[model samples]
Target: MKKLVSMALALSLCLAMFAGCGGTPSSSSTVSSGPSSSSEDTSTSGFENKELNIAIFEGGYGPEYWEEIVDRFEETYGVTVNMQISPTIGDIIRPQIVAGNVPDFISMNDNDTTGLISSMIRENALLDITDVFEGPGLEDTSPLKEQVLEGVLNTAKCSPYSDGKVYLAPFNASPMGLVYNKTLFEENGWELPETWDEFFALGDKAKEKGIALFTYAGIHPGYMESLLWPAIASAAGIDTTTDISNYVEGSFSSPEVMEVLANIQKIAADGYLMEGTVALNHTQSQTDMMMNKALFIPNGNWMEGEMKDAPRADGFEFGMTTAPSLNAGDQRYVMTSVEQFSIPAGAKNPELAKEFLRFLYTEESVKLFAEKAGGIYALKNATEWSKDYVTEGVYSMNDVYNMGDSMVFGFAALPEGSKVTPRDEVFQSVADVMNGAMTPEQWAEKVEASFTEVSNMAK
Candidate 1:
């Protein structure tokens, strides 16, 4: 239920939080590179041993897509899977878990509620899936294990401080990339930005040309929030993954972080950003920008496909960029995360949960999850995924695309905080500064407050 940070910037909060894992990949984007085709009959997945009630996520790849396959899992194991769709979903499904009402499998991991699993593990509510990745008693999961993308696997393993083990198996990968309006850039004699200064200077030019440069989902902030990590890392010269993921309160309020907000404010004040951005979600903002009335929109590559249908007359060519820093010498990160999945400890069948966890990593399952979800697969050696818009976007280091710095997770404005607080409180703290109701200092204070209130959850 927690919102995902951005990855190649794949995966979403079903439709709430969306994000993928870090860094702009090199010219040759990483994908299926480990194991090749499989000739195994993984048809049943050995789930026939239990009656599984799966609470599939809303807006996630539906059970319909894999129902037949799960049926095979059921048939081979002489079991039945009663798919229970989660009409109500988010980072934590504690109410259902507490009431003793739980599906066998529930797919939602954003590290926001990863605490739930950690807590569940304390009570033995879930199984330790270390075996899922480092196989011993498991079947030949090579194909499936190979299917999971690296970034996706990292996001899947984003949890820290667990006792030398894992509780989740990523089913797919989703990275974050900057989605740009290509034709507008070409029409205006603009090229995709390769550095941080280009990003802001172009805003000045685009403003003069009456173009609303970048509009993003401020109300629904996950991947959008994650974008700040690299932006700050690039600006602050911080790169250690440990600092990126779990840094303290004032860490994000530093000058580097302040500077990025200052630029965003400058862009907004200069009228380079779309109007009503504060009121808009990711889709709406993309709609306005792709309509070509607005020039550029900051979004995960997921928005790339949505804009593909925009009339070319409006000049909607798709391109991506990594968010920028103050200068070129700064250390950079792709600032990405994934929408991950895990089974609760209270799950009816921990062994069955372990089996389904294995099923999710299979080549067929990972590939199927990717094809339907449109992101990278989560694995040590993820499959090559350049064909799709989402996959292509994450590999922003390509010739056609480039980045300002390496990608990072985040320090400021995490998706988990947004899930705990009302989106309005989360966004208005930033909006208030842009609107001049709060200065950067006061805004920083308020931002910390909004975040600290949510941090209480981790405690």
Candidate 2:
């Protein structure tokens, strides 16, 4: 998948450099000044006889749930939903969008390395569906805005432009942390660590037993940032993390940020990471943990489904938890990874697309999505919707509230052609520190320099 993304990104970059890929958003791209409270039924929305096109990203999950929802929608509204499913949805459909052909709805993720959806945002090609939330939900008469889980709308990823208008609807809630073998911990009589001191002590014990404390897949910043950033937020405080996320100048130079970096450097210097881990791809690192070559690997909730059939040690059972905190009584933050859905500005049936989105929050539709995909959407009480259907490792997060609430990587709007400064890139420094290529002090200096460059770009 990374290779495919690389190839597609290369092609897109070539096109962008030579063919002027900037999109002139049609006049229809204007959003309503505010949300509408109209009490209109789905069938009476003048889209009953139209076609609503949907393009969904098929990543480690089937579209069976979407198919079921589409069937019900067609039976109710007399509309045909042309559903196009592909693992390479970003690579294929993004080009069509660039050519002025658009789907009414798209579920591609902007966080993917390909940056397909980000490119569209830069081109102003996505519709603003703020009115969808103001409308009624599928099963109740209450407004959809009132049905969403709290703090979800607070996610900066929902509004990339930072203008307070929602261009994307957050769909799936995938929390990330250090995934480990529950059976292994039980057998070793090791308790899950709640603080940095205890966590490092466990690392010492694991080292004596020929098991490394932690390892991560490759040197990708996105992968490691999920684990480290939340831990940093918990240790340094969310305000500092927020400043860094929002591109506040010199935020990374804060003492709190430095403290988190020093602790991570200690882990690297102590030889707690598995040998050759920096070179391993995501699946290979996961395989190492599965085979008991390492004690824990940082990853998202999707780990179980991603490695369901892989070879593992006897009695292996997956488990996950938020990053261990700086102190025993500190507030721990669980880093969430959410997938998003959106409508194109020039979609043929924008109203119908929004109707389908609102229908997703319905009780029956939410249940069906969980049962089929083992994924939970962001509707109210969505996490508790179906326990039996939630994925294995994901189920452990049901107890996340016992520690603290969940938060995702901070979102900041970056200008076009801006490169992600090396200082903000966490994984590379992790790999470098672990491999003895850079000292912690040197790493700090590099980060300070990088952020300064980013500050210049913003100006």
Candidate 3:
């Protein structure tokens, strides 16, 4: 978990450096027209199969980027890419995976509700693609590992076993937090709150203007993790947050964490949460927030792209901020939402799949992704490199990294045959809390009990 601890500090440094460098890309600057396959000589040669099978999840970012990249990969290597891209890609691939007809590469995440990635983790069914990362980059002399943001590859998301080997490759690294309309705040002459006291005070002020302070995707309560993890880190400190991720016995029930939980409860109890928030799904909640029905929504940077075509209030513009701090000058934390890519343990063309993964980190692919999907890749300087391609709002979202510490939130992998998932134990109860069916103390106690179960399983 030292790697996990270092990730926050590493991101802080990356952001600081980015902030200090003020120069913009020149007008003549352009992404490479195509992927440079010269440096990929060793990895791409002599493919047993001239085809690479890929399954991608079409989430907030659409399939256009993947389609374009897959086409480029095919053209560069003279191969056919059989790609299955869908919002419910997990469902389409699950049966194939169960029958041992797994794809060469999968672009889904561990948190997908289909439990595909999590099941693979529990069964050790993912390919140990550590070499893919340790090998040289496709377009540069540096190792692929050196090209990515620091401390990201070592997390449980990538190295589920905590053994310094990466099974999952990093995809998009997005800053997750409170998303609001910058224009609305400016029009109202409202300042972003820096601490919880000011947060509640703002809630009161907004209430007078007929605006609720917060709203989240109620049906998918896990979305609240954008707010929850950062708030916990701000309240209890990063080490305590890591302790919670590791499922230490008292981490969830500790006094500081309980205070964070209580404040979350206060959002509901004090009527700071919007009406009908308990029934809204992600799109609905986001739409309402954009329409000014609620002042803020717990979400990530991709939200802007996802809702690009959706209706909004006059002068609507996306803005984001870290969770309110515990004290005026206390360091805040911005939880990072990292999607993943992995090869199944049983793949027809592991070598080719590895090559494709390497290609994805290339400057050409990174810029293409930013231009087509309006999202940044997980690689170092990706935002800065693609700033001209993405929208101004998406570019400004990177400022969250500069404003606060960046963190990735995931509990330690559960042992095989374990009956509980710590994430579900925590987030699933959020809807109940919002509805007054569960108290914050009860929420903490329930989560602690599940953690105890996981701890005992290790014994």
- Give all TM-scores, in the order shown: 0.73, 0.84, 0.91
Question: What overall lDDT, based on C-alpha atoms, would model 2 receive against the true structure?
Answer: 0.71
lDDT of each: 0.52, 0.71, 0.82
lDDT tens digits, residue span 106-215, model 1: 66544342345444533555555565666632345454434444433333243333344555566444445566766677777887664657886777777787776677
Name the weakest run of 10 consecutive residues (lDDT summed) in model 1.
1-10
Give the clash count for each candidate.
Answer: 54, 0, 0
| True-vs-predicted CA distance for residue 85, candidate 2, Å | 2.4
For candidate 3, give the lDDT of residue 338.
86
Candidate 3 stretches with Cα past 4 Å from truth are 1-33, 37-44
lDDT of 3: 0.82
Ranked candidates (lDDT, high to low): 3, 2, 1
Best by lDDT: 3
For candidate 3, the per-residue lDDT at 355 reads 84
Error of 1 at 38 (Å): 8.0
- Give per-residue CA lDDT, model 3, range 74-171, as digits (tens): 76776778776666667667877887778899998536987778888888989999887787886777788888888888888788888999999999
Can you give the lDDT of residue 296 in candidate 2?
78
